[model samples]
Each structure stands twice: as structure tokens, then as C-alpha cells.
Target: MKGASSEGRFVIDLPDSDAALALAGVGNQTLHSIEALTGASLVIRGLELVVAGLPTQLEKAVGVLELIRPLWQEGQIISSVDLQAAFKAFDKGYKEDHASLSDHILVRSKRGIHLRPKTIRQKAYIKAMETHDLTFGIGPAGTGKTFLAAVLAVRMLMERKVERLVLTRPAVEAGERLGFLPGDLQQKVDPYLRPLYDSFHTLLGMEKTNALLEKGVIEVAPLAYMRGRTLENSFVILDEAQNTTSAQMKMFLTRLGERSRMVVTGDITQIDLPGGVLSGLVEACDVLEKTDGIAISRLTAEDVVRHSIVQKVVDAYARKDS
Candidate 1:
């Protein structure tokens, strides 16, 4: 009651009971964003947050907070209108130079894309993709590592900046062991690349995507298949790059021919390579970070795009590691 609104008044209706409980998990997020945006305190009790600030700033904060309410507990499909509106509400002067991709890719109104990265590192990742021909988005799981890469790749392909799209991921098994994963090479690698397929399917629609795949306009393959290949005039994405050894990463990087751009995204935190083996993605990042043409983008737990709880989960583990 201390910080109860003076003028700003709005009620946020969550979807259901599950959403309400989920919202509780991220109660602090509202507080943090309000403090950052309005220079005021936010107190949340149950599903309601009492935000005290100047009326105009509080109203703006209220609207921006509502845009992400559905995402407090779990990832939801947020409409383009909602995303654009949120961007406007969250706008602070000239858009940060590090948010180029976010500024360019207009998510269709009412068509939800499950991504919400709220840190300088995450914004840098978007900026890198916009400026580079070959980029490595390296970070931890749930950090929007692969999904954001795929989304940018799709947007570039749609804009004709690239002639086609290709996605590939290493098929290495972590602990479960893939010895019994069924079928042959394609079957084995399919599971690892399924996330890429899911994102593409959601963004491009199934029929058109299938048609593109059939015509070889969109190709998804195992990391091994990328060997001895030269990709030109295409937007190629390599997911799960951490599973790849140094040699394989080198080969994949070399495959970037003229006029082609590639995005190799992986979480070094989840590399599945053997103890003595070095991950190519890990190595490439070190080397490329020193180079001129290539871009190296790093995302942190603060950029987790899943549920807000997912961000906390990542942060908890990071603290343990430290």
C-alpha cells in the first residue's frame, strides 16, 4: 500500500491459475524493470504490483510490464503488435546501437515469437548478426543462443539478403549415449537439429518451408555433412556447434564461400566434447574474437529467453560455478 498508484490504473488478467503461480516465480523481475525504467520502487503481492512513480512514467511502465506478464512463468507466443508496443514502451532515447536486429526484424502482429532477451550482452548478439558475414553466438542453454540465430537467419533469407537458408548441428550425445538412437546418420542427427526445424516451421509456415526444403532452397543437415562443402550466397546456421571438435569447426567455417554469411551458435557451457578434446566453437570464438571481419557475440544467463524462472535457474548455476 506504500507505493500504490496515484494515477496510473490498469488491471492485468493472466491466462489461468498456472500462469499466476508462474508469475510469482518472476516477481522480482517486475521490480527490477520498474526501478530501471521509472526510477521508482515496485512491490508485488500475489499477482498485483504496486508501482509508484510519476504518472506518465508509471503508466508507461504499467503497459510494458503487462506485455511480458504472460511470459513471467513460461514462454508464450507474443504478438508483433505486443512486441512493437513493448519496444516503444521500453524505448530509452535513441535505441541502443547494440539492438540492430531487434530494430529490424518486425515480428508480425499477433504472431508470437518466443524470445525476450534483456541484457547488454543479448543486445550485442543481435547487433553482431546484423553487421557480420560470419558470426559465432556462444553462450549457455536457454540464453536464446540457437533460437535467435535461427530467427535472424530466417529474417535475412526472407529479405533476400541471402539466397537460401541452411541449418546444421552436431549430433554428439552428452551422457545418454547415442549408440541406440535408432535409424542411420540422418535419423541420429535429426533429433539434435529438431529445435532448428521447430523454429523455422513456426516462423516460415510448414507448407512453404516444406516446399523450400524440397527444392533445396532450405537445407538442414548434420555437422558432418557440412564437410567438403562450399556455401555461397546463403544464410547458413550451425547450431549445437559445441559438440563439434576443432577440426570440424574449422571445416565448417571454411565452407563459408563468397557472398555467404554464416551464424554458428552454441553454448560453451554445454559442450559435449570429450575431456581432452577442445570444442571447435570454443576455439573459433577465441580466434575470431581477435580477427577483424568475423563477429563474436556472447550471451549470458541474463539473456535467457525462456521463462523468467529459466533466467534465475541459469543464474543459480552460474553462481555455483563461481
Candidate 2:
């Protein structure tokens, strides 16, 4: 298929140079991915897009392009997730579901940066967060569980939907010994919450993030500090809930006050608790599986939007565990 297994070519005209480049991606890498995945050679010449190879392959590749046309037509950047979603539609014959994946923007920053769900499960997760007062997002790393929650929280704060945003996590080490580290309590705890802060910094620049923090509009603290307080009119996120004890999870969930929203996100497979301790995230999911006014969005390796290798790594580990 790489060297022309069949004598055929398909040509289609794009609307403009922007759409052509958007479809081809930077340095034509998107075309390379499409070609490698579909066994069709794809190239762009000005506004004319060419697909060459076996007739069936050409048709399939063109079908994928049509499915993802919603993105490129809007000058949106497409990634491996988009390609995978397209291939999934091609195989399952669910093109309409795949096409709606790019239909909505979750949030946009002041600098014109748009953040949206990269997969179907993510879209559902966002919707769950919007509808439910308390939601649990269980998944592996790189699934955007906590990141999406942070983006929505930021949007709520900016739009005055919420009075403040509170980001908290259990102060648990992940397979690393931190007891001997030389720092105060806050200094020692900063590293654990750094990832959550990184997401805010990306959505809002460092200057704006610091300003919000200084104004107390955004609060980052450990879960222990959340005890004995009602978080009213706030968007609260508890990261790494898998490390929380049953009592701790119950305490955190009870802290939800009127007009407050809470999201608990964690990866149960990566729990680093003591041998006999149960993960609060696991326990909560089991207890609340049938509860009303709450949602549990479980993302899998397919929902991972990081580099493709990360998905492979998750799948490999999952296979070994299974």
C-alpha cells in the first residue's frame, strides 16, 4: 500500500489555504498519520488534497476526512485523538457521533486558546460535571480528568457563576518517600498540587493566576484543611482522591454546601496507600453507583489525549494487570 498496490488516485478541493494546512497539520504530520493508519498516501498541493492507493483504502481515507471535516473547516487543530475517533467511526459506522465530538468548546481563554473535550467520554464527563452537584471522574493519567475540572472551574469563576474556586488534594506520596525531605509543611505539600496549578497557569497566564490567588478567588490547599467548613458558592475539586481514606472522602463530600459544585478525580489503579487501607475513590464509586444527582465518569485508555505512547503504556499495564 505504501508503494501503490493499486492504480488509483482521488482528488478533492479544500475551501482555502487555511483549511488545507489545518487538514495537513504542521509540517504535514497529520497527513503522515492518516496515511500510516489508513494505508493510503495523502498529500496536499495548494488547495487540492490528493489521496492515492488501493481503491478501497482511498475511499476509506476520504471517508475519514469527511468525518473530521467539521474540525478542519473551523480551523481547529486536530490531534491523534481526532484521528482515532475518525477511525473508530469508520469501523463502527457511527460517523455522526464522531462528528459531534468537535461540535462544542468547553472553555476559551482571553488569549484565544480554546479547550474542548478530545474524546466522546470526555464530552460526557464535562456534561456530567455541568449537571451534577458532585461528580467523580475515575481514570488513568493523561485522561484530562482534573484538568477539565480546573478549566470549568476557572470559567465559572471568571463568569461570576461561582464566587471562588478551591483546589485540594490528599497529601499522599506516590511511591516516593517524602518524610525526610527538608521543608516546612506547605513547602513539602506544594509538589503534590503542582500539576493542578500547572493546568491553571496554562489556561490563564501566570500573571493572572497569581492575581487570582492573591485575591483569594482561587485557593489551593490539602484536603485536611477542608474539614469543618462549608464551601458555598464555590467550585471545589479534590485531586488524587484515590489516596483518601473512607472517612476522609466522606468528610470531603459532606463539605459541599448549597450552591457549590465538587469534582473528585483520581486513578484507582495507581493507589499508593498502605497495604491494608482502602481507597476512598473506590469505596465511593461502589457506594454511589446508583445514587441520583451524582455522576461517575470512568475514562479509559481511549480517552487519553496525551502523546500516543502514553495510551500504549496504559494499555500495556492494563493487559498485564488483567
Candidate 3:
């Protein structure tokens, strides 16, 4: 391997053209992503990569490349998702071996999508889900709150830990009124529940999801329908709960029965409840913070795993609000 001794810079010579191509990705997108994430200037000349920046950033960039190089060398394809996880882990002061971060697979979807925690908070959230009967995932969007909850719920159902899966969400609109919606009650509320449906579709293919829905093994409905039912032996997830009123939240929580697990996910900052209406999620947390068998996992912009700009957008709005 070629090496450079320039101050605040390092050069790594790839072992072969295939390894270099894998590291660089198609059109050098992978190299560009690393540069953007670590604030390093990565330039490729033949099979050689030159990383130049501040000492710390250069070090981080080189370290990330070194951690991922083995995967590529072993003929494993590294995607942007993998790189993002590495970047987040490094940024969050992860001291463990980086390979461990990439190796911790949470779930493998039917379509072969491997889901894992992209940040430290996410790792803790997954642990909380496993250890607690009720988990409150309070966070900003794109933090994998609902997605991970759905993944766990599907796994539980497949393993027969629960006989069924229940997914619900508040129907409160951000600003629009639902009165103008078309079709019957189910149709009116289906739009609000589409996100949960999308999650299940991702984990279990559309065909199997539809079959389960038909068999009543999977139920996707709005929070209003949960008023008078006792959920037993099921994995239930309440998404977008910030819009629920105090009474609604209490009712939903009370429905949890024996052999059941519930995950409540919401972004409090995006609450759409009417004036003077207290959000059930916020109030429930205040009341249940000390309760046994319940756990809360709070995720922040640092836990966001969407497009990198999403994290910046969350930070920008947070700064404005503060």
C-alpha cells in the first residue's frame, strides 16, 4: 500500500482496481459522502486516495475508510446506508470497534433489507423495546422510531411472541380538515394510517401484509377505534400520538393486556391538537415516567438517519424555537 507523510493529510493506496472501485462506489459517490460527513477533502488518483483536512477530521475519515475497507475487500457491497451509520457512530463518540457498529443487525426484511441502529440512541431504543413492556419513543422525524417499532412488532408476530400486530395513529391533521375526505369511515382514516402500512409493506412484502390483514393477524386502524377494546397477546404501536388528547392517550394505554407489548412513538414538537387540548403523549409521560415495566427512549436530530439535510433542518428549527 502507498503511504504519505504529509502533515494533516494521509494517502491510502488501494490494493487493486476492484477494491478502489468498491471503496469509491459508482462515480465516486461513496468518497464524496465520506468527505461531506467528515469535512475532509478526499481525492482519488488512480488507485490512490488522498484525504486532507484538519487533523481530527482527517483522522476520522481515514479511520472510517479503514473500518469499511475490509467489507469491500471481502466482496461485500457497502451502500450509503452503511456509511451513514458509520458517520453517525463516529460523530457520537462511539469508542467500540467500528465493525461492531456495522455488524449489529437488528432485523433482516423479507426483501433482504438489513435494519440496524444508525446511532447510539437508536441502539438504546432497540434495547428498551426488548426489555420493556411499554416503550415511549419520543423523537424527531426520520429517527427510526416508528420504523424500528414496526420491525420489532413483525418479528414478534412471526415468532408467535404475540398472536397479532396492531398499528394505530392519531387522525389529527396538521392543518387540513378531514370532513372533506371521501368514502366511508375506513377510507377517511386510511390516509392517516398509510405510514404504518408503508412500514409493514417494507418488512413484510405487500402480498403477505395483505394476507395477514385479511386474516386479522395484522390490524391497522386509527386511535379512535381503540376506545373500548382490550388488546391482549399482541404487539401494538401507536404512531403520531402527539395529536391525541389526554383522554385518548389514557384509553389507549389502558388497553394493554397480558402478554402484550406496546410502543408509542410521537414527535411532540409537531403536535396538531387544538388549542387548550393537552397532548396525551406528553401528559402520559409525565404521569408514567416512574411507572414500572415502562421505558422511554428519546431520540434527537443526532439520531436522524434520513438524508443528511434532514438532520440540519431539524437543528435549524430547533435553534429557532430555542
Candidate 4:
């Protein structure tokens, strides 16, 4: 049996080349995750590993290493069962005390909106819709900000909470390169709003979604066309709010009419605005945070509902920012 120690080089002598390869694959996954999660360094030499970190981190790494050892046995397939077990055990031990979004939105219907969030952020967002005529969700990406807002807008339209559903985004490109596109205004702007199309297809299915669009019950338009009209008694969502300049944002907000609500969602980290232009979403958040009828909820990487590794990467980037 290989000895478990406080700090040292460890060698797990293997029987054959296949076993060696399997062990190395598992080790690489574990080491990469550990380094990403805890800023540890792992140096691997064949079957031997030189792990350098604080004692507790090294102990945790060793524990993970030992857990994957049996799967590396000759003729054993390092199967999904082993990986699931290891990840599940680690997840169980590391209960995410950070608030999660498993509460407010539920996956009631089968096809549309697969995720159900039951956390404070989601409830707060929903409540903001109920109370305020306009709310902004500014946070990191993959935090269910845009998706949940879209679902809520759909529900409002379906339940007659609002008269219509209006979805739009800024048609800004990486380099102001709209003229180079292969189509006219609507077609050119369509690509920027692809995410909205995807969400709509998932929620309403293709035929009904098309019918609703034709009837104007569901409108997908570019921000430029939004300048002349006011949206009333409707649920309006401005996805990718970071791309909207402060002036554009204010114009959109002022276009809100009676019995209407606007849910603006964006990741400040991903702002594609011109170098000096401040995002309307971020500026609105700063100005309206303490206002009576407005709500702003910020989500972190911890609120990411995607793969666990995504959370690790987001956290690593956030640390780098700090």
C-alpha cells in the first residue's frame, strides 16, 4: 500500500502500460481541476507525482489521487461510473453554501426552459417584475440571467400578465462591421439576436413562435428601431445590455409605458461597448440601485448553472480580475 504523508513525492507502481495510461488520464483531470480550483501545482513523471502546495491542499490532492487508483487496474475501463462517483463525492463534501438559483423558476413544461431556479436571486428577479415597471439584471454570464428573464416574459405573455413579449438586443459588432454583412438591416441584426431566437424556439416551438411573431404578440426587433415607439402593457427584455451605450439605455427605459416591465440583462465583464462609452446597464445599476421601484440583482460565477468546471474557470478569471 502506498503511504499517505503530509508532504513528499509519491509513486504508485503500476503493473502495465495500459494501467499507467489510465492512471495518468485520471491524474491529469484531477491535477488540472485542483490547480484551477486551489492554485496548486502538480508535476507528473510517469507514475510518480510531485505535488506542491499547502499541506491541506496536498492532502486533498492525494485523497483525490487515491480515489481514482482502483479504476486504473489492469483490464478495468476507467468508466463513467468511476468519474461520476469521484465528482459526486467531491461535490457532496463541498456543499456550495453560496446561494443557488433552484427556487423561483421551475421546469414545468417539458421542452421549453429545462432549468428550474429556486434561489434568492431568481425570486428577487421575479418579484422585481411584479413590483417595478423596469428591472435590470447585471452580472457574470451563465448565471441564468437572460434565460430566466426570457422565461418570465413568456409566462407573462401566456398568462396575460402582459399584452406582448418584446425581445431585442444591441446590434453592435466587434469592430463596427455591420456594413460588411451579407444582408439588409433586419437580416444583419438577426445574427446579433440569435440567442433570443434560440430561447424562443425552446419556449414556444417553431410554429407557434412564428405565428406569435406574425401577430406581433411576440416582437423581436433591433435597438435602432426601438427609438421611435413606446412599449406599453408588455414584457420587454433587453438582452446584452452591455452593448448599449448609456444614452441608448436611457432611451429604451424612457420608452416604457403604463403596465409594462423591462428586464435588462447583461454581463458587465463582457461589455463590447466602444472603449470609453459606459454601458447603460451598468450606469443604470449605479444610479437606480437604491431607488424605490427598481431592482438590481448581481450574480457571480457561483451562480453559474452550467458544468461544475465552468464555475471553476469563472472563479479563476474573477480572481485574476481582483
Best by TM-score: 2
lDDT of 4 at 169: 90
lDDT string, candidate 2, 1-322, tens digits: 1222346887877888778888988888989989988999888888888898888788789888888887787676778877876887787787777678676687776556467777778989999999999999999999999999999898888789899999999877733455666687666778888988898888998999989989999999888789999999999999999999999999999999989999999999999889999999999999999999999999999888888899999999999999
Ten contiguous residues minimizing lDDT sum, candidate 2: 1-10
- What is the per-residue lDDT of model 3 for residues 5-85, given as tens digits with 9 covering 90 to 100? 666779887777777777877887888989888899898788788888988888789777876765556444567766876
lDDT of each: 0.69, 0.87, 0.84, 0.70
Of the candidates shown, which would achieve the greatest lDDT relative to the real structure?
Answer: 2
Candidate 2 local Cα displacement, residue 228, angstroms? 1.4
How well does candidate 1 match the true structure, expressed as C-alpha RMSD?
7.6
* Worst lDDT 10-window in candidate 4: 94-103
Model 2 pairs in collision: none
In model 2, which runs have C-alpha deviations exceeding 4 angstroms? 1-7, 109-111, 174-183
Q: What is the C-alpha lDDT profile of model 1 across 230-255, one tens digit per residue?
A: 99999889888888898998899999
Q: What does the lDDT read for residue 137 in candidate 1?
A: 87
Candidate 1 ranges beyond 4 A from true positions: 1-103, 107-120, 174-184
Candidate 3 local distance difference test against the native? 0.84
Better of 2 and 4 by TM-score: 2
Ranking by TM-score: 2, 3, 1, 4
